[model samples]
Target: MRKLLGIIFLLYGYPAFAQADTTQYRVAGRKNLPENYGRPYVILISADGFRYDYATKYNAVNLLKLSAGGVASKGMIPSYPSNTFPNHYTLVTGMYPSTHGLVDNSFYDPHRDATYNMGNKAMVNDSSWYGGLPLWGLAEKNGLVSASLFWVASESRVAGIPPTYHYKYHNEFSNDRKVEIVKEWLQLPEAERPHLITLYFPEVDSQGHYYGPDARETEAAVHQVDEAIGKLVAEVSKLGLPDVNFVFVSDHGMLLSDVDHPIPVPELVSNRKFVVINSYSLVRIHALNPEQVRPVYRQLKKERNKDYKVYLTRHFPKRLHFRTNADDRIGDILLVPRAPKVFGSNPPSKRKYPGAHGYDPKKVPEMKATFMAWGPAFKPGKVIGTFENIHVYPLVAKILDLPVTHLIDGRSKVLGKTLKSP
Candidate 1:
């Protein structure tokens, strides 16, 4: 247990965030708001890896009370693969990961002849890898201003627009400090205030990864987020900002992963015919040629056991919404491990977490996420059934009256009923 605690501390280095980019990135001379500045303010907050049952199970007092007064869902189903970067981007983009071209946390972009990795700062900030327009992009392009404390791809100029005010990813700032910063943004002048604001918390997700979902460490992380959110609501209320609403969500959830008996990498996977990436939850094999796909897939299927399921690109369930819209980004072959088990071999991350996600949320309900909303814009004391996170995008757009001029996977009708509107 001591070893586990020590590893948790080492894996998460708040001090290292000091060396990272800590400046608030602002677009020069672009503090302008739309002619109709009456649009409601939406603070979209994501607590990474917050499970559907967390608030209730842990008795997160503030969250339970706040959500009770507003709207809460049984669960918010994350897009397939249920990983952090993909689903966070999905929540704001209104598209599935494949549709958005962010197939996984890391994927091979055949067209770019490059790989897009969540850890690769250059790749993450590159606009070309992204397909869908994020909420911030939609707001900015339509003459509204947006800000993000930290969100997946928020720093990137996706669709040629970054949030008017944003900060590059950094963990140095404490939860209380983040809430303070958000309150300050709301206090800005009408022209400079961001109607669409996004805030993210990583502690719960980070702790779940290091200590498993049921550990005391995970509970503490959940409470910490609950406290910060309570503080945010209290502070923001002092400003008397009308039509201010808050949406609290999470990318995905965590499960106690079976790290003791991991699914070993197949031998043929090492062949040059494919570019393989083991992204914890699944193994993506991007074959060099269509011809190379069949032989390897057959071999994998023959060897497949209870540990994992292997599929040709087209064979994946359409309900998953994977491969129905994308093949290149999702790869030629997918090795989806039965949850609790992940793809690994002789050596990868010398140390690994007992908790993992990135599985199909439909199958592993443990991957189901969280969704709650409050403030004047929401119908009070409403409880809704599970819905995909993509629907969140249109819900925000509807709240702010932003036009989503393009066709995307998300349908506001799924969540539109929760609003105090037609």
Candidate 2:
């Protein structure tokens, strides 16, 4: 028994003789370090499709308590084309889809001669489609261990390194199982334990899509997720890790789909050569002939009504911070539909979900997501105004004390108000 314990201690950097006093032993190289040697530990959680108002609307008691005890935001506006994959990556990289190369949930890259889609596991695991360093990669490079419970891009080797510990995404895992995994990681020896962690919950988003955002099913999902959060908090407290910081956010909110008002894609463009990437709330029209771009834009513009609007990517509104790159993956022409309306090649009967996202964050109230933080690093009882989701990465980098090694659209100063001095 003694020999086995010694081997375990050697491998994990624990003090073998004093197993009961696990808290006194530091990491291998971090012994005798000052109190402020490293940044506060962080656990970033994403409740997929949890809208900004869900806390109040569903009476998520745990979420409300978290908000009142820490920093809360009125809303977190997602980047343009507010979808799951793009916005989730934006939250970690602090770059817009245009900059990060994840232009949409699915896109065709002419340079790579490849089509990338979220459902394609090979494409998702391939690092060729991802641009910039994710938080886990950055943390690993800086000598901090990181873990992910199904965060976007964490399963792949970004910046040439995956998270120190991670699992392949499987929505079948129950929330209790996921929380237990997180607790196990937290219980590891100091050297092997992750300093940065991310947890993703997709139940709220899934329920919203199936039953509509305002349905009782969606409200029940919100309640269930809140209870899970409470359980996680209790576990953390039981472990006595008081220094751990927590950030809760969602990629985008849900809007009801108007089955009666599907935009007629075939009527808008008779050209068969045009590639239409329809994502319900937004549509990207790729013209085979560059000359057809303007004509397609004009035809779509003629059909524009209160339900939708059309624009040439080159002339896309500067306020959107989109179309900044000449080689952007976005199509030549953009089609943005108003809330409850959608753009698709097929009729509404073929569509599956009653709720959808990927709309203009500024114009649609339903597309705004949630952002809340609690820990020693953040100020208590502070309510911040709405801000863009891209800014989240900088705040995370700041919390981890990671150097800004790459270009990102987020400015840390924008979120500085949420933090208290260390």
Candidate 3:
């Protein structure tokens, strides 16, 4: 009963996300090559919050055996502020969150004078809020068809295009159905088939958020996702499609944070002087006026301690890739709290759940993501060390033979070695 309720919490927890548009959407008349069946197939799978060690720790038999036959990474690194929306977008766009304009899961955009929150359906589907060319859009632009069962910005018309086949975000969609849909996509007639497909899973992340990463619920969630992936692979393999490949990854990992004695709402700076978008994992402070920036910065800095660190936009660690070469979307002041100590509600009531993420993965090694690939395209039984998630974009592009027209932070060389030589 506890596990069942946890599943419900992850899948149906958000009343706002449960919507009427659960049906699959298609873009009619989008044609690919004359001989599309010959094109390489890449099914990109993301199991959100699947920590680097969970597969081994939880004994995810199918995934371990599958990855063992192919290439597995020691771990995959997420871009700074290891949140979901930003890192997922980065994985597809080959750009850092700051560079890509999703600086955080929730942020203030001064130019637009609006905030982009992951939960706000209007902001989520609004193409203006997103930046960078997602892989589906990349494939579509290059005359190859693409599909997304679910992904950040997939519902949005990113890069002025959505995938040929896609679906709006919803939690009720079952894992079995998603794999069936992917199979149906590949089973399509040649010209109408999607060579590149993206699928996302939220079960693991959900359980991790509600029950700490090591809890039985989380372990059950991991095993469930593992079984689903196993089913997906087995079903797809029966089709005997040529040159088919599978790349499994996660947006970021999970961590256990102290729910008691949480970081309260910023009381030092006047609320009127600044706008605070506190997601608990981190906080973004937006100043109402440029003149008020330093005054607020100083106030927060003086109070900063082991609990959290405050950085003005200009001073965010260069390695974070957040401060430099950024769009105005990044907050005027960034507040990053350390592990087991997350930003919290006023009066500091104990949080309902102990599990959390969005910490700097470098500092919290558990926040590091996972990466593995198997198929005709990957080098068998190889293992590579940690590499940034940004490079995943270029690797997928190279697999589908799509051309990247714009500049991106991800370089093919970072992950090019894992692929079989052309």
Q: Which candidate number maximizes lDDT?
A: 1
Order the candidates by lDDT, highest first — what do you get? 1, 3, 2
Q: Least accurate stretch of 10 residues (summed lDDT) in model 2?
A: 23-32
**Residue runs of model 1 more than 4 Å from their true location after superposition:** 1-18, 324-327, 345-348
**Residue 334 lDDT in candidate 2:** 79
Deviating ranges (above 4 Å) for candidate 3: 1-13, 16-19, 324-326, 347-351
At residue 184, candidate 2 shows an lDDT of 88
lDDT (CA) for every model shown?
0.87, 0.80, 0.85
414 Cα displacement, candidate 3 (Å):
0.9
Worst 10 residues of 3 by lDDT: 9-18
Which of the two, 1 or 3, has more lDDT?
Answer: 1
Residues 1-422 of candidate 2: C-alpha lDDT, one tens digit per residue: 35434432432233446524112212234211233334568999999999999999999999999879999999999998889889999999999888888888888675665667887667788877888889987777777878888888877877777787777665445678788888988887776777788999877887787678999989998998999999998888788775889999999999988856676665655456777777777777778778988776776677556677788887888777777553557878877876788765563445356788888889888999999999888999999999999899989889878888778899999998889886
Question: On residues 35-81, what C-alpha lDDT tens digit does candidate 1 reach at each position?
Answer: 74787899999998999999998999999999999999999999998
Candidate 1 Cα RMSD after full superposition onto the native fold (Å): 2.5
Query: Scored by Cα lDDT, where does model 3 land?
Result: 0.85
If scored against the real structure, what TM-score would every candidate get? 0.95, 0.89, 0.95
- The better-scoring model by lDDT among 2 and 3 is 3
